[model samples]
Target: MADNDFVPLTPREGAALGDDVYAVLGEAILRGTLRPGDRLRDVELAARLGVSRTPVREALQRLERLGLVEVAANRYTRVTEAHPDAYAHTTEFMTYIAGDAAILGLARATSEQHTDLIEAVDALIARSERNDGMGILGGTTAFYQLLIRATGNHVFITIMREAGLALQRNLQGWTQPDEDVELRTTRYRRLRDAVVARDGRAAESILMEPEPSALALRGRPSLG
Candidate 1:
């Protein structure tokens, strides 16, 4: 795609400016608005976002570190193509980390935090009903993020931040078509109930259940 063809991002009102830019650009990439091999020009993005080139550059660098974008000095900066094995690897990592977080979170979470988790699960069901791919992605991320926060493990949080981005991108690529809204809601409801009951083992089991997409990734001949 041409440089001018990239979708423009609106300047966000709150939070750190760089973080907002990173989120907007990252979501665009995850949504496939910025496809693989599409070049990212900081000057154009800066102009489009009504920000200085600094944050755009910073965001681009952050994306590169996440393996979402490739930057070759003086040559180009482009969105990276999906790796065929990424889905399996990411799901494996998320299963363990998120499962552990669920156990710890159940142990650590306060009454308010339990309520927040239930609310997050409700939001996930709502997004699934609407078949909103991005919403589903964000809601799932938020649910796990809350759990990770409750664990108070900064190291795991950092790891999730890095791995979660790739997982979201891969999920966005494959999840929508086969997403069963009823099944998803049922699964999340079970998870929420477990967390609310402080049933750590049950919560872990629910979270670790093999996702359809992960199973497909293992069996499919090709991602294409």
Candidate 2:
């Protein structure tokens, strides 16, 4: 990847290098943008990111923690297929985001935010009904990004940066075969309602219902 492709982080311009690196690079790896088994050289990455080895090392470590990248016997680093921990961690993290958003969105979100989220859900559900997995994947990410934005919390933004990468990784599992669009969209719609209604309880329930569908939703979310 070209160094210019990187969205640079300035301490003053906002965002931490390590976390930004973790989230951006992690999302690329997860979404097949980087691809499985792609070799990564720290020097090359550092150059591309316009940062030194320090941030790259930190990013690699964070990715390793998420199971998005692995070090080979020869000391080469490459993206890998999802592990059990990846699935577990991604799900848990997403639940945290949704739960937090639900709690904060209640009083904090403007009426416009609620309407926009509901509209996004409707659009996503419509696209999913068309059996467009790619569309669903992209839309889902955007919807959640919006959810985090609605919270108006800086932490949510960072959490979202991390979650975006995990979400893309989860999407990979869906590319195998046609997923049950109806079922998935149904869940998404319900989840959207919970958010709009500011119903943290129902949103929590919606989050829990998708575990069995993890394999189908793979490459985008954690597998059950």
Candidate 3:
């Protein structure tokens, strides 16, 4: 990495410091600031982030756990290639989990929460209309975040929070068919209306259906 490429961060102290570093570096990787096969040296990152090497190493360890980076003792630590299968698996995982979350959350959501979810789904529909890939990705994530939060399951919330970065990376470049955008937009509208009506089963069924993607969620081929 070039010296100019590394952005310095304000120094932080204590346990949360590690998390901040992890987020910074993880976001860098996701945004292609740190591309695949790029090497990471703790000392350099420590200096760049204005922290001790220990926290930099800790951050790297966390990234490695998420499959964003690969590490070898006394060898090298580098960003991993964006595996095609990861995208398929992530979508599959998200489809089912979001379906379940919808059922639980819609049952428990207040009127205010229902309004927020409807707004989020509206954003998704707008993004779909323009075929905005990244916008759709972000809007979908936000909509689901609200849905999951409504479920009031702490463990589920924590798990999804931990997996958020990996999910973003894996879902990058994932898109549905152009022809199906209108269909999906209709589905999203139905989904929004279902949530507004507090029809949990209808919302869940809409989300659980397979989208128009090469990587079909239903009966997807397993990796060897």
Tens digit of lDDT per residue, candidate 2, span 47-85?
Answer: 776788888889887787666788875679988766656
Candidate 2 has an lDDT of: 0.67
Global lDDT scores for all candidate models = 0.74, 0.67, 0.80
lDDT of 3 at 2: 72
Q: Give per-residue CA lDDT, model 3, range 8-33, as digits (tens).
A: 77656554878889989998998889
Alpha-carbon error at 21 in model 2, in Å? Answer: 6.3
The model with the greater TM-score, 1 or 2, is 1
> Candidate 3, 8: how far from true, in Å?
2.9
**After superposition, candidate 3 runs with Cα above 4 Å error:** 12-15, 126-134, 180-182, 211-224
Better of 2 and 3 by lDDT: 3
Candidate that scores best on lDDT:
3
For every candidate in turn, the CA RMSD to the true structure comes to: 4.8, 5.6, 3.7
Per-residue error for 202 in candidate 1, Å, reads 3.8
Model 2 deviation from the true structure expressed as Cα RMSD, one decimal place: 5.6
Please provide the root mean square deviation of candidate 3 (C-alpha atoms, Å).
3.7
Candidate structures ordered by lDDT, highest first? 3, 1, 2
